[model samples]
Target: MKTLILFVALVGYTQALSYSDVLEEEWNRFQLDYTKFYQTEDEALLRRLIFVDNKRRIDKHNRRFMAGKESYEMGVNQFTDLLPKEFQSQMLSSLNITEAEGLIDFRYTAPRDVDPPSSIDWRARGAVTPVMDQGENCGSCWAFATTGTLEGQTFLKTGRLVSLSEQNLIDCSNDAPYYNEGCKGGLELNALMYIMHKGIDTESSYPYRGTQQKCRFNSSNIGASVEAFIGVSGEANLAAATAFHGPVSVRVDSEGMQSYKGGVYNNPNCSDEILDHAMVVVGYGNDKSGGDYWLVKNSWGTTWGENGYIRMSRNRNNQCGIATIAVFPIV
Candidate 1:
């Protein structure tokens, strides 16, 4: 009996060691160091949980890989390993965004020559598209997407790039009827409405805190304004709108987006079930293999996707709900 007990303990120890080795390799590959979360032995259990969670993620990634069906790379990066699910839902969900019942109807007066070229990138056209940014842990993707489209439009109209304030919308947009939740979430449409009714301030005036705060917008410090907004449909309309405007904000079923690394992201699991996350479509192009893709600008910073953006599979009948809830602000 003593020998059997000893043998069981040895097996348990080997399993733990194997898990530790695999966790270390994943951390190294993703350039993470969870040791920073340690201050006490009780707190150190977080490391164990993280290690376990990373293993779970690895198993999931491997399954996707083994199926020979992965269109994007999966990694144990910040988004996949750290961000909480409740926070992601709060950040992404604006409460039945696909309803489209109260959507505003506005006539567009854009340049007649709106037919986009084979491909167009507003960043390369001397537009002041700012560098990629992070929203931390707040359910503030709505604010980020709102500010991104605003920044792009400001540059397109004035020929000057200016980083607008997501913090401003996070603080002040609660006044919007549609923006019921402050930090928890807000609709990009409501954000555009706030900008139209009350102009937005710059990032310098109201830096992002990634959380809810009392409204403190300065009217004198307004930086950008949206003259009107337009709803777009299909690949052709979205592409044309992007070329005529700058960036278009769209909501997508991004439940599977965190694990994505690069390539034309087309996960069979992600469907148009609902619109959860808001993003800006900056441009579109076809790959070498003629796979059409939408260049989407994400707010998760530069380390997340192909440098803070994703080339999602486009023209696949609106795969991943890319154009389901799409719109762009007219500056």
Candidate 2:
């Protein structure tokens, strides 16, 4: 009987060690997979991986990346609450949680029905800029989109043109909690709100690093200040286009964006699901096709679209709340 008991103990110890080994192996694989996935242009698998419910699998991957750091411990509790309950358990069982919260939220809103600025010159509009591609494993899109729009608008306003740093908004912006970190998804209006409330520092003051870091406080504010905010009901009104002179923040669908490669995108077959991504409308007019399109500045990078912007069809009643919240920058 003693011999049998000893044998059982040995087996249990081996089982425990095997479990540990499996986790270590999986952790290594997770890192390699993540790097390869991000570096390559192939997004078919990535789109599947990101949109699917794989909280536990992702938690393990995050743990491996954040191993041996103080942030890891903090991530343990934070990630638990952030992941769905089922995923939390699966991740905790195999790996230590390091980074818990996702940056993007599907729900948020801007102030409603404000008028757009009228100073915008539709004739002066330039070619669509390149698409700004936000690499995977990062969530600085809000800052990028905000800065991208600001850059175009500034170019239209001054004609000198300057590339505003999205990284500034990612790191700085004290108006909203999510703005503090680019890891969490944020809205363009939030950046505008910060600019209006606190004033913005120049791109030279705050450069775009493409990653999250500590914020540098500026003593002098530079961007236009907003006096009031209003909500509009539909997209057909000329008021929506007028708001472009100021910051007109709008939300649109961005799910299949990973595959977007430039075109007059107006596919009725595509899903109508709208993403929380925001952009600034620099100008609007009837395209050569006579279809009304809003000249939108994007943050993906200059390599993607018409330079770095897209011409989305407007007048669908602001289908996804694109015309809902328009803010005029107090000139």
Give me the displacement of residue 232 in model 1, in angstroms: 1.5
Q: Which sections of candidate 2 miss by over 4 Å? A: 1-135, 148-162, 174-181, 220-230, 238-240, 243-247, 269-273, 288-290, 317-321, 326-328
Model 1 pairs in collision: 91-139
lDDT of 1 by residue, 1-331 (tens): 9999999999997877875687666655543442244478765565556646856875787577657666666655565445456446544655475445367576334456545677777667765355445455576777878888878888877878888888888888886465546667778888888888889998888887877888889999898998777776666677777777778888788877776677778765666647678788888888764277898888877767788888888778877777776777877
Q: Once model 2 is optimally superposed onto the true structure by TM-score, how far is the C-alpha of residue 163 displaced, in angstroms? A: 3.9
Best by TM-score: 1
Clashes of each: 1, 30
Query: For residues 135-244, could you state the per-residue lDDT of candidate 2 as single tens digits?
Result: 43456666655665555455556664555556667777744443444645655556666765665666666766656678775657353333333333346443443444
> To one decimal, what is the Cα RMSD in angstroms of model 2 from the true structure?
16.5
